[model samples]
Target: MKIQLQTLYNEYLNIKWKRGLSPVHTEPFEYGLYEDDSADLFLSGHSEATFTNWMSELRPEDPYYGSKPNGMPVLADIFNQLDVYDELVLYYLLFTLNTTMSIHTHNSYSEMNDWMKNYSFFQLAQLNGLSSLNDEQKGELRDFFFFFYLYTHPVNEETLYACSFREQDLIHTKTNIKLEHYFSAFHDHYSENRDKYGEQFLIAPHEIQACEQLTLELLRIIEGKSPKLSMPSEEGLEAVVDLINNVEQMLQMYAKNRTLVFDVMRNFLADPRTGLYRNHCFTMLLQNYASYILYFNFDEIHALVNDFRDTPAWCGIIINKIFTDAIFIHKIMRKNAIDIREYPNVIEFFDEQAREFCL
Candidate 1:
């Protein structure tokens, strides 16, 4: 069944490519179904009105009602004649089309609001054939959805509030309900199944260990300890860099209030690094501590002691070192403030220090 679905999907993509309608080559800004004539090929003889009508049915209260079908009727009928997996594939394709194209249209705002209000994550999952998936396949799908939500959803309250109020009263209420409730439900579902699904659902064990080692290396650099270093994968390095950037941004934003800075720091540090390098947490700790020294006033440094006490023993020691030695703090901050640019420079710096140590 999976093989058949894959074949159909490949065929669909091949057809699109042949017709010069492949999404891969097109700019995302050029992806609207209503705006792009090439997107008509995706409808497979069904009219744009037909697709809209189908979407409208997903939320019966949709403001733009149409006479079209709910699922892609042509493809649905073809796949329905085969196995349920085929139908699932068709639905998945439809869902992708809706997300990638139709949702970009001006008219789609109300339609999307209505649909999100009417459907739970699980219901949408089921509609897309997720219920029939094996545990391994389900885990992969979960990762896709989790990252999609993480990257696409508004990260801050202000943006979320703006999205909540973007349209008509009916849509405003529905959109808020969907965005607010979806993540809670997604977290609950993944949390319950995480153990049974195993570590493959996130980062592999070796990546986690590498991340941990990388964390220690970053901490040593921040502390002026000149520890021996082994290079981590590019992905691990990037994750560490991203953590540093996030911490620096946070510190810059909340530099005025020491308490609020620590609060924000703690919240970011406490988040699980699911699908990230194991040392991700450690990198965050080092970055936050570094940012603290860079941004916080010496007089207000005493407030950080309480916060450090709540962290790991190692983190506590690092925090204490920054608080106690003014000269050491200045030296560390000066060298560490050089922004990490190319990864090879970091590797070379460590390599140079190793030869001096041996001598």
Candidate 2:
């Protein structure tokens, strides 16, 4: 199993990513990950630009080569293409919070930094397919993290320097946790940083604690230990569950009444447990919801436009293209000397949202 896992990791390292799609140490905006056309380009599966093509290339031996029915691969199904350990590690590297930052700061660096820093393992487990892994696979994941932390060169400080700060902290903390203390230097470095920054910059304190608890829980489950005393670690797990539930509720409500989405947004943003503000993954999902809702629910324009003001400023900014559509419509109506009142929905929505351009 170890040999096979090593071979898979080697193959993964050898696999090349599409330009601009590769793992980047720089901010998402600086690298164009959040460009207006990114989602469209990704959904369209153009050449090597989309994840679908990337995964298809990964599993060339398969008959279908990882193509899904929609031609766009879902996050969960992406894991099914790889060995359990491979998925676990790669997912962590790709999505987990990394402390590395560009020395050159972008204007919205703090905003994007919050997103990057708070994209923790708990969220990844829910967003990725780890939550759906079978018991055997779960055991393998647990054992992989355990043995890999101890026996592997991950503990070497020199090697860790190349890793993101979050991964390095996890290794050091795990070593001390196992009472091995093999990486005291790393632990001391983590301590100094935590003191300076209030916690490890790479991984939040709660998340680090959660990861430890999760591993212990997995060990107990593998050993047939059924129920145990309640621990604070479960809070992190519950946070992920709450996030998934809130997203589902928001999406369902959005389909019925676009206006109701504002209420959902208020509740989600106000509730600290959802962590939507800090989490890049969830914030992007909300922005996506707003994007489509704006175009498809123009009939509910008055309510939608009015309620959107109550959402975070960033929400409106992220979907600024919707405002562009309003501008185009208003211009056309004015050019024909059309009575804007005849189009009450558009006029009212435009007046409320883009009042400066209203004729």
Candidate 3:
């Protein structure tokens, strides 16, 4: 029997959040297995006591877990166990479910957050089995994943990383998969979605360019390799502020190298001799960038606020902005269930600034 991939995918989505199918772990990088009954989430309208049982009839041996014990099922041999269509359904479920259940993250650096690693592990597993497919099957599989990535993930979040992973997967697996084979189809898919869905389907190019430029300059200054930077133009300043205002864009920028950017900003704010702090435009940029520093590294920001030294009175504006951002980020982190121990006690820092700035 031929199985339609989209129909199977829709069916999986329906049962993915059913009572017994939810993942057992919610912590970052600590993805555990779904409940035993989750096997039915992909069992083509059938149910099984466990994922292993669901696959027992299809494979010659028991499915083994990958790097993470008891995390997700991995079959070493998928060459001839199932028909081509069923294999597509199986691979789709493996990839989509792994991404959905893992801790949601924007960081592409696996060392900082292994959420991508967890998702890519199963992805490589699926790619390893692609050697058995013909050109048509390979094209279908690529489109299946490309469409899903666009459908579920926002462009400002994981889109770039997803694109990177697909390219890297080819190298890692050494399969005959031709990325160019699907480029036209992928663009058409995105265009169709954009046409149907409107602005939510778009990425603002100007905002991205501004973020890239600002991030590069900040990185240069922190490394003591100044680029003879000039103050941003009035419009440039507005673009920078716009990038900061959009949390998803800010996250996309930070995911490049969060720790390095945090360190750069922390050092920049701590030193009083940084002449840029004297320029009105530079000062505004500093104030806005500090907000992101606080958003990403509350602990370091807390220390920066506490370690303030004697400086020009105008520096108070930067301090005030930091304090305000701390309050805002604290509430945001709490609302999103982000576990940041430094957030609760941050009010004291803002309180001190409130008095000093007479706000």
What does candidate 1's lDDT look like per residue over 1-359, in tens digits?
Answer: 01122222223333323333344432111222443323321222223322222223222122124554354322233223333322233223223323321222224444333222211121112212223334554343333322222223212332222222122111113223322222223223334454554533343333223322322322222222332221222333443343343433444444556566565445545655433333433433443454244433333344555555556543343443332312223333344463223323222322333223221
Task: In model 3, state the lDDT of residue 264.
Answer: 41
Residue-level lDDT of model 3, residues 1-359, one tens digit each, is 22222232223322332323343321111122345423232222223222212223222122233342332222213222333333333333323332332333234333112322222221222322333344454444344333333344323222222332342232112223222222222223334444453443232333222222322332222222332222222332444433322433444555574443344444445546423212332333343344334433445544444434333242354555544422333333553466544344343434464544333
Name the top TM-score candidate. 2
| Clashes found in each candidate (C-alpha, N, C closer than 3 A) | 3, 0, 0
Rank all candidate structures by their TM-score, best first, as comma-separated numbers.
Answer: 2, 3, 1
- In model 1, how many backbone clashes occur? 3
The local distance difference test score of each candidate is: 0.32, 0.32, 0.33
Q: TM-score of each candidate?
A: 0.21, 0.25, 0.22
lDDT of 2: 0.32
